[model samples]
Target: MSPSSRTPSGATEASDTPSEADETPALATIGEFGLIERVTRDRVQPPATLLGPGDDAAVVAQPDGRAVACVDVLVEGVHFRLDWSAPEDVGRKAVAANLADVAAMGAVPTGLLVGLAAPRDTPVETLEGLATGMWTEAEVVGVGLVGGDVASSPTLVVSVTALGSLEGRAPVTRDGARPGDVVAVCGRIGWAAAGLAVLTRGFRAPGVLVDAHRVPTPPYAAGPAAAHAGATAMIDVSDGLLADLGHVAADSGVRIELRRDAFAVPDRLAEVAPALGVDPIDWMLTGGEDHALAATFPAGTTLPAGFVEVGAVVEGEGVVVDGEPYAGAPGWEHFT
Candidate 1:
């Protein structure tokens, strides 16, 4: 007997032959529970997951007994463009961006709760690809796909809430920077911004920059390392470097001055700047989304590997680039 003939109605049969259109589409509307199963069905759950999907809430084992949480949302047109990024890339980027926040607080990501809103016409394959990407990226931070919700909407939107454990370490917040502290960064800067520039203007560049935008590989372990090394304050560079540093400066009641020449421009960027008729320096200084960790440490403290001293904290307010006030775009704003 043929596989289809033996399979029960509404059940998808594993066979070499393509199924007929008459086959009922998997659960219409991808109802909340159905959508959840579709996304988490094949994902690998971490051992830290005390209780996974299918309840009012998921429980994660926090070895330190305290959990740190951060949430971020990605709207269809606001955060990404389907034309420029694939569904898998969108899912990974959405999850990675939020995980970077938890890492910035010097925490080990434990699990994620995702809420997806999409039109009924959205393809099940697209949703599956997104779920695959989310798990792939979450694995990088040692987290598990615990739970989520789904609903109908006009456009695709993903909201993820990431939970992390501090491992008995105190969270490194933004208000601890002080005068006489050193400012440092771990991971690339401007790569994502430059990629955006190319995507928007049709400028040609190396694939690395484009990949940077699709999936940011943040220095996940550096946050906890910096915290252990006595970092005074820390934040992930989601906004422009100067703009993000300004937050540290304002909150910590200090001034930050970045030495632009301290960091070299990647060869790929220099190669494409002229083609785009833009300065690489502008991209480096004003660009964002590299998800690099920036922190303030004691003046004489030695920065850890993967971290470079880019600036200094002084007794004042505002952030300065190379001893001068930064005069450029102020980074991403929701309303602007």
Candidate 2:
């Protein structure tokens, strides 16, 4: 079930109810450290963390003596809508998207730092709930919330920076995909896109797609697994499949030929496509935000479970879907 649906009965309605008079503003600029404690208290820390939220900086145990870091930013109206997604869902997505970048580097996430900007009138309870969501999702990836900053702003803007350890494995980059490599993917694809379509069409789905849009359940462990299994190149599918693959192709100077029939698109998506006046292939090829991992492995390599072979690398440039260059929308951009 989606987190919003799972919220206790009347909790949302109660939150939505207007008060006779706005409560007195708690305290302006509660100070960063004090606010951090308020948010991170009662949260669990990861086993690999040598130190957690406190001090000037967090200390994490990096067995490989190297750390992978990535950052993501979410804007209120552009990336998410407060009316549609709860604050908690926004928090979870902010952390998950950054963590996926770490995973794409073939590393296990170790810690995260969140930066939140909300209106002065934003409810303290809502901020706390958002923190809870961040902690919850970090726990799933075996990471800890190490620190953060909060400030007043006109609109909600969440930025997350994630740190990861390679566990002695070499970091995977986009330029390593050689010709004759097999391309594979781990985790669901296009669900978030389909959900976006449903939301745009003013329709409701079976909760799976909405949940996907809220919190992408990526195969976090599969990234390091692929590296150990000798993956040559890797990336996260935050941008549509073809657009992201194009990065690998451009970097490696090779062509990617995706076998569309190999994708495991959910039946719910197919069922809703006609009703929503959307095409399933559009979701499968050009949808983004699913945070799935896509990697290229040497031919004859045995792929780990939860990953499926979806394409292959060839001697050329750009990506082809089923032996032809797919001419669809490119992908997502911050400002277009």
CA-lDDT, candidates in order: 0.80, 0.80
304: Cα error in model 1, Å: 1.3
- Each prediction's total of clashing residue pairs, residues at least 3 apart in sequence or on different chains, is 0, 0
Q: For model 2, how big is the CA root-mean-square deviation?
A: 7.6
lDDT value, candidate 1, whole model: 0.80
Shift in Å, residue 335, candidate 1: 14
Write candidate 2's Cα lDDT for 1-336 as tens digits.
Answer: 001212335333222333443464221334334446678777778777787766666787878788898889999899988777887888888888998899899998988987777765566666776888888888887788877666556677888999998888889999999999999999888899888777777765658898888788888889989999999999999988888988999999999999989886679888888887777877887889999999999999999787899999999888888998786665643212
TM-score of each: 0.89, 0.88
What C-alpha RMSD separates each model from the true structure? 6.8, 7.6
lDDT of 1 by residue, 212-266 (tens): 8777888989998999889999999888677788788888988898998987888
Q: Which ten residues in a row are the worst by lDDT in model 2?
A: 1-10
Query: Deviation in angstroms for 123 in model 1?
Result: 0.9
Q: How big is the positional error of residue 169 in model 2, measured in Å on the Cα after superposition? A: 0.9
Residue 310 of model 2: what lDDT? 93
